[model samples]
Target: MSNHQNPTHSIELTREATNRYVARNAAGVEVTFGRGEDLMSPVELLLAAIAGCSSIDVDTVTSRSSEPTEFKVEASGNKIAEENGGSHLEDLNLSFNLSFPDDEGGRKAAGLVDRLVKLSHDKYCTVSRTVEHGTPVAFETEISVGREEDGNKDTE
Candidate 1:
């Protein structure tokens, strides 16, 4: 999908109790819940949304280039009390590590990282864009090639 286009995704949530819910995405991915018990804390969910969106964009862009690729994305952010009675999330940081087929593949993969971030922060990734408007968000990416011993390559 192009950055100029926004795809619609539907999320269905069933409230299990006060501050507790079970949510499912359009793809039938099921997520169970509790207020702060499960992995669905508000902040955690937001980070997940951002990570998911960016990862999808990167995968799509890289796959279209006909290069074999695999990726794992992990995101974390800290919230500091706002000064002057403002909103929470004073600062947010997101880090991504992308593993490619080889050194050149790593470089090419890295090249797409920024584009993914831009698409997410500027045009797509509704969750990231929405959160960024309220707080300062920073992103960092690292790219590396998967080693043959990493069980990522076929051996003959």
Candidate 2:
């Protein structure tokens, strides 16, 4: 017999309705995703992930110097439609707003902010690295038919 180690991180997503899904992490944190303005779409989540990853890197370094009063990140991108009935995000950008205490320590930390941000994009942020390197992603899907009360019926 052979023992195999599972992937370190994974999320489970359940489709709740049309274009709506609930994704759950190992710690039971749940996020709701939907197609319309009522919820975050997949594209929005991608942008958020990129911004969040970088923000985490910057925040981690800044916190060691001084207590940050505020940290905000805005992520945006353009979705380009492809000829094969698909779309992709292009021109991804993230705007960061950071605030620190009005003191000498804060000033010192502020001086390092830009360098930290650059370091984050260059080396620290995994999401940014994956996007930049054009990493190939593979998916495995399983279909379960004739389940009970799944909100849809198979006419077979």
Candidate 3:
């Protein structure tokens, strides 16, 4: 077998109520999401992950020269449903608007913006690359039935 190794990234979600959940990462940081009210939906989280991955790529490269005065990235897509009951996002897009101060370091950083953004989307961003390459996702079921007492926690 080859000696190549890949790091694993994972998050676990626990349901709070009927439609609400809390997602926790390995570091224990948590984010609450759900279906009711103004909470972000799963689709929104996917969009954010794409934009966030690209943002990290661009910032890592650009900040080597100078810090950005402003950095904003927006991910957008049309959620569409097929006749077969499957739904997916269409026309997905990520837009970046970054600015640097008016000076040499800033100019140098600004000069790298376009290339950095392109490189991020085409190469560096794991999230976007995984989507663009159509990576296969395998699903397995490991459900445990809780009995007797206070609705024993599930969702993980």
Model number with the top lDDT: 3
What are the per-model C-alpha RMSD values against the true structure?
Answer: 17.9, 4.9, 3.6
Whole-model Cα lDDT per candidate? 0.70, 0.88, 0.90
Q: Between candidates 1 and 3, name the one with more favorable lDDT.
A: 3
- Writing each residue's lDDT as its tens digit, candidate 1 over 1-156 gives 554645765688778778888889888897776566454786677778788877777777876544546567787776766677754554566666666666665677667777777776677776777776665657676444654655574444
The TM-score values for the models, in the order shown, are: 0.60, 0.84, 0.87
Scanning candidate 3 in windows of ten residues, the lowest lDDT window is: 147-156
Better of 1 and 2 by TM-score: 2
Q: Please give the TM-score that candidate 3 achieves against the real structure.
A: 0.87
Where does candidate 1 stray beyond 4 Å?
Answer: 1-10, 17-19, 25-29, 36-38, 66-70, 82-87, 103-107, 134-156
Global CA lDDT computed for model 1: 0.70
Q: Scored by Cα lDDT, where does model 3 land?
A: 0.90
Q: Output the lDDT of residue 107, model 2.
A: 86
Clashes of each: 0, 0, 0
Supply candidate 3's per-residue lDDT for 78. Answer: 96
Write the number of the candidate with greater lDDT, choosing between 1 and 2. 2
Per-residue accuracy of model 2 over 1-156 as CA lDDT, tens digit each: 774765777899999999999999999999999797799988889899999999989888888888889889999999899999998888988898999998987988888899988999998898988898998989887565886686674655
Question: Which 10 successive residues of model 1 have the least lDDT summed?
Answer: 147-156
